[model samples]
Target: MTPAARHAAAIGILDRWLAGEAAEKALTNWARTNRYAGSGDRAAIRDIVFQSIRCRRSFAHLSGAETGRGLILGALRAAQTDPATVFTGDRFAPAPLTDAEFATETALPPAPSGNVALDCPDWLRPLLDRALGDQALAVLEALRHRAPVFLRVNSLRATVDQAVAALQAEGIDTRPAPLSPRALEVTGNARRVQTSAAFAAGLVELQDAASQAVVDLLPLTAGARVLDLCAGGGGKSLAMAARMSLQIFAHDIDAGRLSDLPARAGRAGAPLHLLDDAEGPERMAPFDLVLADAPCSGSGSWRRAPEAKWRLTAERLTQLCAIQDSILTRAAALVAPGGVLAYATCSLLEDENSDRIAAFLDRHPDWRCDLSRQFTPLDGADGFFAAILRRVD
Candidate 1:
């Protein structure tokens, strides 16, 4: 498809998204209906739609409207492109700009200010400010763009150097990420990573560098008994297995998330025991390490899931915090005497990170936090928070 047609397609998808359809679902529905569109066309349209969502408020202010057309116009203006080229009223392109639309463009309003300019929700600004402080704007600005792709080298299958060589042979270039020794930041042809020999050979897995860094910090010993309390997809469980000889048991409230773990673990040569919610905690009790990778607002990952940023509400955040609290409380029980209880979240909010840890420490006077870290976009990885607490008595 032509570039103009892609933009037009993106506008339609955006309209569907604005009308309460999910971004992914709207894009999927469009793709299914428009079977003539090629992979490249679909990817381009998806990018345009996500980018517009990432800066929805600023784009709306710039285009003097909040419609799909306005967002596309604003996107073109932001890119310093001539919107007339795309909105040519051609057969496949968007309709020509009206007199009012042209006037709005000519008399573009002054730039947005504060939260709007930063592409943050007004209600979320204070929370982000409190969490990020001086780095708030930088982090928020980072979310307005695409996130970097990172892969974790599975040491069980191949060394970092071997994995790099294998990936390079497949035309996918990667460089070491400072955040974690086992991480490789894909530098080129990242789209081909899944098909690369390195990935097929189980030498690498798609995981955020910061997420790997969280596992790197864990104090694991050979043959350590570990429990991943909220092991969604078992990413951390795999990472831990790669690092050392671990009797790893993975569990999630929703057992369906762990359905693929057997295949993934087999591919990576990592052995993981799956557990059901009814008896997993009791059977796996007294573990040396228990990781609670709890759910949150996903604020740190807004760049990849931009729609989540706009959809999150104060009520939802409050509910998530409550859930995090409950998970921490329950997971603490499964930790053996002197064992470590790790709390983690993919969020930059203090309420979900540091504050939650503080609350946990208060409730469990015998357990003390030993280490805590927060990873942000500034760290060149998705934002993450992890804290290790140890039982004293």
Candidate 2:
């Protein structure tokens, strides 16, 4: 497709989104009906649509209107691309810009402030401010970009040097991430990662550097009984297994969320015992380590899903806090005396991170916080928090 045609396609998708249709659904429907678009064309169009959405307010202002045409023009201008060359009025290209459109290009809309400036909802500004302080804007700006692909070197299977060599053999380049000893940030051709021989041979698994650091902080030993209470997809569970020959028991309140664990475990050569809610008290036991990787607003992942920042509501955040609290309480009960309980979240909000841990410690006076740490997107990884607590008899 011509560059002009790509812009036209993006405008079409943006129009559907503006009409209240979901971004993914609109993009998918467009792709399905346009079989003439190749994989590269589809990916390019998708990037244009997502980039526009990520900076909707700013793009709307620059483009002079919030319509599809305006957004594409604004996005192109923001990227410093010459629209006249692309919108050349050629076959399959967008129409030439009118005198009115050209005249109005210089008269941009007012710059949004506070939440709107960040492309986030108004209700969330205060919370984000409280959580991030003077660095809030930097954090929000970081979200406007894409996240890097990180892989955790399965030390049990291969060393970092060995994994990097194997991955490089497949034309994949990587650099060591400073955040975690076991992490390697994919530098080039990251999209081919799933098909790389290194991945196929179980030498590496896709994981955030912050997530790997969180697991590395835990002191796991052979023969230890561990319970991953909120083990969604069992990423950490599998990582922990690779760290030691531990008797790992993974569980989630919603068992269906863990449906991929068996297959993922098989590929990683890690053994994990999956427990369903129906397993009941029969599986209840004092575990040496109990981990609750609770659900949250997913603030850490905004770089990958910019739409979530606009979709978050005050009420939804409050509900998430309550759920996190409950999970901490329930998961703590399964920790053996003298054992440790680890609580974690991907949220950058203090209320969802340290605050929840503080509340739990208040309720359980006998448990002491062993260690706690938080990371932000600017720190070279997704924002995350993890607190380790030891139960004292």
Candidate 3:
């Protein structure tokens, strides 16, 4: 498909998404109905749609409207490209820009100030400001772009150099990420990773560098028993399994989420067990380390799931904080005396990170938080927060 046609397709999909359809679901529905769009076309269109979502506010300001047409036209203008080129009114292309849209003033980049410039929701701005303080603006600005793809080299299977070489042989170039010794930031052919021999062989797994860094901070002892309390898809569970000779058990509230973990663990050749029953963790209690990678606003990884940024509400955030609190409590109960209860989230909000830890400490007077870290887009990966709380009693 021509670039113009792809933009037109993206505009349609974005409209569906803005109208409350989930982005991925909308993309999938579009692909199923529009079989004429090839794989490359679908991918290109998805990128455009996601990019528009990431900078929705800024683009809306530039185009003088918040509709899909406005967003695509504004994206073109932001990149210093004339909207007329893509909106040619040709067959399969977007309709020609109207007089209002073609105005020179609106064609300029969005104002470099306020929520529009930051692309942050107004309701959440004060929370981020209070949490991030002086660096709030810079971090918010950093989030208005794509996130880098990072792979965790499965040290259980291959060395960093070996993994890089294997991936390079399959046309996927990677360089070691500074965030973690086991992390490799994919430089090229990121899409081919799943099909590559290295991935199938479990030499590496797609994970964020900061996520890997969170695992890097784990004080894993040889032969220690670890439980990923909220092992959704088992990314953290696999990372922990590869870290050392640990007995890794994966569990999630929704067992459906752990369905893929067995195959993944097998491929990685890691000894990862699944506690399918809700009572399973309690039965296998007193683990040396328990990681509760609880659900949250997902603000840190918004670039990958931009629609979520606009969809999150303050009430929902409060609900997530309460859930995080519950997760910490449950995970703490399974930790061995003197064991580590690692609470983590892919959220930058203090309410979900530091505040949760504080609340946990307040609730459990015997537990003490010894280490904590928060990573933002400024850190070159998705924002993540990990706190190590030791069960002292």
Off by over 4 Å in 3: 103-112
Please give the range of 10 consecutive residues that has the lowest summed lDDT in model 1.
277-286
Q: What clash count does candidate 2 reach?
A: 0
Task: Estimate the TM-score for candidate 3.
Answer: 0.96
Model 2 — TM-score against the truth?
0.92
Candidate 2, position 317, lDDT = 89
lDDT of 1 by residue, 27-52 (tens): 99999999999988988899999999
Residue 51, model 3: lDDT of: 92
Off by over 4 Å in 1: none
Choose the strongest candidate by TM-score: 1
The C-alpha stretches of model 2 lying farther than 4 A from their native spots are 18-22, 88-91, 95-100, 110-117, 280-282
Q: Is candidate 2 or candidate 3 better by TM-score?
A: 3
Give the TM-score of each candidate: 0.98, 0.92, 0.96
The lDDT of model 2 is 0.85
